[model samples]
Structures are given as C-alpha cells and as structure tokens.
Target: MNSQTELAALLCSRLCHDMLSPVGALSNGLELLADEDDPEMRKRCIELLEQSAAISTNKLKFFRLAFGAAGGFGDNVPVEEAQEVINALAAGNSRIELNWAVEEQSLPKPAVKVLLNLAQIGIDALVRGGTLDIGAEKRDGNVEIVTRARGGKIAFDETIGKALQGEIAPVEITSRTAAAHMIALLADEMGGGLQYALSDDALVLGAVLPQPEGMIG
Candidate 1:
C-alpha cells in the first residue's frame, strides 16, 4: 500500500488502542454494578458507571468529529454541534473557551476533523489550569481553524509536534501522537496545511483548508 494509506491504517489502530481501555472499564463497571446488592456500594458503582459512560460517549463523539466521519445526519453541521463536541471533550475539568467567527458556515467533514483533532491536542497540552481558545474564520474560500492554549505551563511531549509535521517515524508515533498526525494528513488531503507553535506559556495550532468547489450555502 501507499504511504498515505499505511499511515491512515496505523492511525486508526492507534486510536482504537487508546479507546479500548476506557471503554472496557466502562463495560466491566456496568456488569459489576448490575450484580451488586449493597445500597452504598451500588451507589458508588452507579457513580462510577455514570462517569465512565460520560467519558465514553464524549470521547466517541469528539473522535467521530476529529478522526472519523462527521456531519453524518445532515448536509450541514451546526456550529453549536462543534461547540458541544469541545465541551464534551473538556468534561467540566478543562476550562475551554471557544470563539467562533463563522457561526453560519458549515465546514466540510475533513475540516471538522482537523479542527477537532487540534482542539484535542490543545486540551492535552493544558494539563494544568488553563484557558483554551478556539476560533474559525473563512477567508477567500479557505477555512482557518486556530487553537491556542494559554496557562501556567503548557506541557506537550515533542513527539506529538513531530507527528503533526509528518516527521516522526511511524513506529514511534504512539497513541498520543496519532491524532495529531492524522489531522495533519487530513489537512494535506484537503489541499491545506497545518502549523504549530509553542511559547513559554501557550501553545498554538492552526490549520488552513481550502473549501470544496461548488459547495452550496
């Protein structure tokens, strides 16, 4: 197979590997909760169950928009949906602030995936308390998505940036870097480009994607 196809398959496998643990834990917790008899234990189990369910659902939704096909139900996906996806990824712990310039524009699936993946990377970079700003603007028939994470200390392993730039070796691209590389490839496929910059207290990622021809309003 060609290099692009191989990279895509590798990325898909990496995503599945990362998601399997949490999803498996969720299933196991549910099974255990169904058999528990003690009220207090059952209550705790229920809490765990709820938390796990939320994680699974939110992660799946975010990944669907980021790494998989999005805008599944309709011709256009609302901006609100993208906002919801980000909030879900944050999961109440990470305080993410979103600023969207194109409220009425419907992004193509590839653009949405690249944006979501970049957001995920930004979230990961801001482990400590921080603010993540996401913006999307359309100019000259091209869509630009920008994500910036500013906080106490933005810490991201170097490998992720390497993967985003398509410079990392395939075997060295772990689950952490898989999403970034996938997003970068998606941007390239859409006739766009990805860029990343890191400052002392902030990390910024940007993607510029060309809009598809003959797209209706």
Candidate 2:
C-alpha cells in the first residue's frame, strides 16, 4: 500500500488502542456498580462509572473528528464543532487552557486532522500546567494552524520532532509518537510543511496546509 494509506490505517489502529483502556474501565465500573450491595459503595461506583463513560464518549467523539473520518461532514467541518471537540478533550483538565482563533471557514478533513493532532501535541507539551494557544489563519493561499504551549521548563522531546519529519522507522512508530508524526505527514501530503520552535518556556508547532480549490465555499 502507499504510504498515506498505510499511515491512515496505522492512525486508526492507534486511536482505537488508546481509547480501549478508558472505555473498558467504564464498562467494568458499570458492571461493578450493578453488582454492589452497599449503597454507599454503589453510589461511588456510579459516579466513577458516569465520569468514565463521559470521558470515553467525549474522547471517542473528539477522535472521530480529529483522526477518523467525521461522519456526514461536508468537505469543510464547522468551526463550532471543532471547538466543541477540543473542549470535550480538555474536560476536567484545567491545567491547559485552550484559546482558539479560527475564522469561520470550513476546513477539509485532512486539515482538521492536522490541526487536532497539533493541538494534542501542544497539550502534551504542557505537562507542568500551562496555556495552549491554538489559532488558524489563511495566508498566501494556505491555511496555517499554529499551536503554542507555554509553561515552566517546556520541552519538546526530540524523538517526536524527528518522527514529524517522516524519519520515523516503522518500529519506532509507538503510540507515544504516532499522533505527532501523523500530523506532520498530513501537512506534507497537503503540499505544505511544518515548522517548530522553542522560545522562553514555550514550544510552538505550526503547520501550513494547502487549501483545495473551491473548498472554502
């Protein structure tokens, strides 16, 4: 298979693998709650069950839009939906603040995936509590998505950056690195490129994706 097709399959598998644990835990929690005799324990289990279910559902929805093919979506997805997806992913994670600056433009599926992956990377970079600024702008006939993670001692791991450059060997495409590499590959496929820089307790990931003819309308 071609590289893009291979990458698509790999990404799908990676997403499923990443989600399985939380979803399974949610299922188990429900079962435990159903079987528990103690009212207090059952109540606590129910709460856990609810939280787990919500996390699984939200992550699944966000992944569908971000990595998988968003069902019934037109050539360009609505900006509101994208924002909602990000918000869902960020639920209960107050350490990272998401700031969106996207125009009311519909982005192609690939472009959306690239943006989401970059957002995920930015979120990961801010392990020590920080602000994640996500913005999209149209410039010179291309759509550019920029993600900045600001925090104390921010560092972008070298392995991830290398994977983003398409130098990741198959064996090195572990779950930890797959998302970032996928974003870079998507940017390359769109006839654009990715740029990354580290500045003053912040790491920035920027990708420019080519806009298809008549896609915005």
Candidate 3:
C-alpha cells in the first residue's frame, strides 16, 4: 500500500478508538436503563445516559470539524464555533484548563482544522492534568497557531513530536500519531511549517500557515 493509504488506515483506527469510549458508554447506559427496575436506580441510569450522550455528541462535533467534511470551501468558520468544539473536548478532562486567545471572529476552514488538531494534541499531553492554553493570530501574512500544555506530570509522545515535525515515516506511523501526522501534512501543503518544544512539565506545538487575504485581522 502507498504511504497515504497507510496514513488513512491509521487515522481511521484512531478515530474509532476515540469514538468507542463515549459511544460504548452510551450504549451500555441505554442497556442498563432498559433492564433497570428500581426508581432510584433508574434515575441514576438516566443521569449516566445523559452524560454519555453529551460526551458522544461533543466528540462527534469536534471530529466533524476537525476531520470530517464540516465545510472545506466557503466562508470562513467562526472562531467561536471552533473554540466551542475545543472547549467541549477539553471539558471531558476536568484536570486540563482551557485558555483561548484567538481574537479573530473567523478563520479559514483549513486554519481552523489545524488549530483543532493542535489543541487535541495539547489536551492529550496533560497526563496529570494541567493548563492547556491556545492562541492563534495573523503574523507576517501567516496564521500562527500556538498551543501550550503545562502540568505537574506532562507526557509528550516522541512519535507525535516527530510526526508533527515531518520526521516520521508514514509507514511507521500508528493510530496514536495520526492526528499529528495529519497536521504536519496539512501545514506542508499550505506552504507552512510545524515546530514544537517538549520538556518535563511543558509541551508546546506551533504551526505557521500562509494566511489568505482578509482571513485574519
């Protein structure tokens, strides 16, 4: 198989892994509700159902914009909408706090996708729960995306770093590195570059994409 074919397969695996948790919980909650008899237990089951549903929905929304075809060509997507999806993804983990600093009301869909993917990686690096601060802006006629994950016990995957830096060979990529790989691929296609700094307590990811006219201000 070709390199792109392998990347697509690995990405599918990652999306399936990510979706399985909440979706499976939702299914289990529904099953439990059906078999539940006592009123109190039934109420508890309902609450679980609600929580699972919210999680599934949030993941769906995030994935739709981040991976699927939310809107590839047209008016730029509102930054608020992009931020909301990132917030939703972060909300799943109470340990990670979100600080959004993008001032633009909207950004090109490609830029937004890159932002979302970077945010996802940062959020995942907070192994012990930490601050995930994200910021984006127009600079030197390019969209500069920045994300920082700082915590007590942060863990940065080496493969992810290599993937984002365009150092990983596609054939060696796995489900875990798919998101980073995709971000690197997109940035390259846009005549941009990706960089990162990882340490014991902090992990930072940045990307610079050639900005379209009037897209960022």
Candidate 4:
C-alpha cells in the first residue's frame, strides 16, 4: 500500500480503538436504562451514559485538531484551543497533572499538530499517572515544542521511538506508530527533525519546525 493510504488507515484504526470503549459504554448504558424499572438504577445508568458521552466528545475534539484539518481556512491555530483539548483529554485521568508553558498566542498548523500529538504520546507514557509538561515557543525563526512525561513508571514504546526517527519501514507502520510517523514526516518537511529521550521515569519528545516567512509578527 502507498504511504499516504497506509497512514490514513492507521490513523483511522487508532481513532477507532480509542473511541470504542466510551462509545460502547454509552450503548451499554442505554440498553440497561431501557430495561430498568428501579429509579435509582435508572439514574445510575443515565449518569454513566453522560460520562461516556463526555469522553466521546472530548476525544472527538482532540482528534479533530490533532489529526484532522481544523481551524477552517486559517493557517494558524490559537494556542489556547490546543491547551483546551489537551486539558480535556488529561481530565479523563485525574492522576495526570498537565503543565502548559506555551506562551505563543498561536502556532502554525503543522507545529500545533506536532505539539498535540507529542502531548498525547506523553500522556500515554505516564502509565502510573504523573506530570505531563508541555512547552512551545518561537526561537531563532523556528517553532520549538517539547513534551515530557514524568512518572514513577514510564511505558516507553520502542516501536514508537523508531517511528519518530523514521527507522520503521512504511509497510510496518501500525495504528500505534501512525501519529509518530506523521510527526516525523511533518518535521522533515518543515526542515527540522524529531528527538526524544527515554528513561525509566520519563519520556521526553521534542520537535523544531522552521517558521514560514511572515508567520511571526
């Protein structure tokens, strides 16, 4: 399969995998509520349905910005929007603490994608729930993004690392590596590269994208 087609399939697969749990919960809750006669149990079912719907909505918002073309015709996205989606995603897991250090009012679409994707990866790495530190800035005519996951236990995926560095063959890319692969492609196209450092307690991902002329004020 061609790289673009494969990438699309992989991303779709990843989205499906993420959405199944919450969507399924919603369905199950509806089923139970339909057959229940107890008011208390019906209330509990409705509450679960609400939670599942919220989770599904949050995921959709995050994927829309991170993986899909959002912001309409604008070439830049407000940093505050990115922060909101990331915060919503992290809210699902209360144990994760997010630190936003991005001072730029907005970032190029490509840079925003990298920032959001890296933040997602960082959140995943914090298996035991810890701090997710995200920062982005403009320096030396380039947009720099850094995301760090710090926890007592870090689940570092070697395949993802390889994907970020363009070490994986196109035919081998899977749903798990699709985001990283896209990030690598974006960095390369923008005259930059992806970097990462992995240890027992932390996983740090960084990217630098050359800012387009007239993009900065």
lDDT winner: 4
Least accurate stretch of 10 residues (summed lDDT) in model 3? Answer: 67-76
Q: For each candidate, what is the lDDT? A: 0.76, 0.78, 0.85, 0.91
Every model's TM-score: 0.84, 0.86, 0.93, 0.97
Q: Comparing candidate 1 with candidate 2, which one achieves the higher TM-score?
A: 2
Which one is best on TM-score? 4
Candidate 4 — number of clashing residue pairs? 0
What order do you get sorting by TM-score, best first? 4, 3, 2, 1
Residue 115 of model 1: what lDDT? Answer: 76
Selected candidate, larger TM-score, 2 vs 3: 3
Residue 201, model 4: lDDT of 89
Clashing pairs in 2: none
lDDT of 3 by residue, 1-217 (tens): 2577787788789878988987898899889989989999999988988888888888888888987779534758889888889898888788889998899777778889999998988888898899999999877789889999999987777888998899997566888888788888888988998999988899999999997766545
Off by over 4 Å in 1: 1-5, 31-35, 73-76, 92-102, 169-171
lDDT of 1 by residue, 1-217 (tens): 2366666777677768757877888888889888999999989988887887787788778767766656656544666777788887786574555444555456667777777788878888887868888888667888888889888889988788887777778687655676777777777787888888999899999888888876533
Candidate 3's displacement at residue 137, Å, is: 0.4
**How far does residue 174 in candidate 1 sit from its true spot (Å)?**
3.6
Which runs in model 3 stand beyond 4 Å of their true positions?
1-3, 72-75, 213-217
lDDT tens digits, residue span 1-217, model 4: 3668878889999999999999999999999999999999999999999999999999999899998989535799999999999999999899999999988889999999999999999999988899999999999899999999999999988889988887888676889999999889888988898989998889999998999778865
Error of 2 at 139 (Å): 2.3
